[model samples]
Target: MASSMVAVGLALAAAGFAGRYAMQALKQVEPQMKQALKSFPKTAFGGGFYRGGFEPKMTKREASLVLGLSPTANKVKIREAHRKLMILNHPDRGKTHPDRGGSPYIAAKINEAKDLMDGQK
Candidate 1:
């Protein structure tokens, strides 16, 4: 009984020491973690495209990017790009399983990009 009690006491002391060491280690790392986080950009990842809240009007540059076209692309190229994107991403294309395929939001964005691109010319 005394040997078991000694073993238990030693185990408890070792655990307490380990926990204290871990807490000290964390405290030392806390300032470095804060500094690293502070150095990061305020915007979300993907170059800030996934920002929260309401979206602004699509710019010409953004339209071109959506359609995978050059900013200086002509009307014919723009039309072709729009057609290709619609064929691939149109929500209606996912007839078999509505939720599993194309996204309505993406389709809407593609259409909006086409309209914006057309109007800017």
Candidate 2:
């Protein structure tokens, strides 16, 4: 019937108007959102205030802990610890290895700790 067609046409016009209104509202909000973000503290996002030294420097003590060595461990002990840990957590050793889970990140940290220990000698 003509009445049904009119109803469909009205519904379509209402949907189009709603869509246009929503787009305008979003446009109005966009600038305000950007301004709010700019006014916010950089540290809140872990980028602005903490850029340079936010991360603690890897210390000899921390390196020894990573390698499971005593603070007074010598070069030989450091090397031994490094090798043992690498054998267990080297990225090449897939995580499916029995009783061990190797990760690329862990392997990198292990290498870094070994290098730090070596540098002290």
Candidate 3:
């Protein structure tokens, strides 16, 4: 009987130590995860951008491609393209209609296309 009691006590002690160690490890890792998330790029066009490398510079042709527009599309065409893409790509719209799989990257691309169009004006 005494041996069984001792064994139970040791098991409890081991479990307590393991739980404390796990809590400590979790506390150490949480901040690292948050920092990593915070350091993620603000704009990632279709998961194309990465860190510590050459940033891809989009030309008017590339921007048009992202917006699903023809290269010869005019300002009004670009605006319509941006509006249509934004309706499908905005994060909020995706959240509200989770079935459609809207992409924040597409929304950013739309914004980029609009900026390019404005710059040409």
Using TM-score as the measure, the top candidate is 1
Ranking by TM-score: 1, 2, 3
Q: Kindly list the per-residue Cα lDDT of model 3 for residues 1-121, writing each as its tens digit.
A: 9999999999999999999999999999999999998888654454564445212876776676667667777778888878887887787885655887676776676797778765652
For candidate 1, give the lDDT: 0.80
Candidate 1's C-alpha runs over 4 A off are 1-55
Please report the TM-score between candidate 3 and the true structure: 0.46
Tens-digit lDDT track for model 2 on 56-85?
A: 667777777677777788889999989998
TM-score of each: 0.51, 0.47, 0.46
Task: State which candidate has the highest lDDT.
Answer: 1
Clashing residue pairs in candidate 1 are: none
lDDT of 1 at 80: 97
Which residue pairs does candidate 3 place in steric collision? none
The best-first sequence of candidates by lDDT reads 1, 2, 3
Model 1 Cα lDDT, one tens digit per residue, 21-107: 999999999999999988876532234464343258878877877887777888899899989888888787869987666778888
lDDT values of the candidates?
0.80, 0.78, 0.74
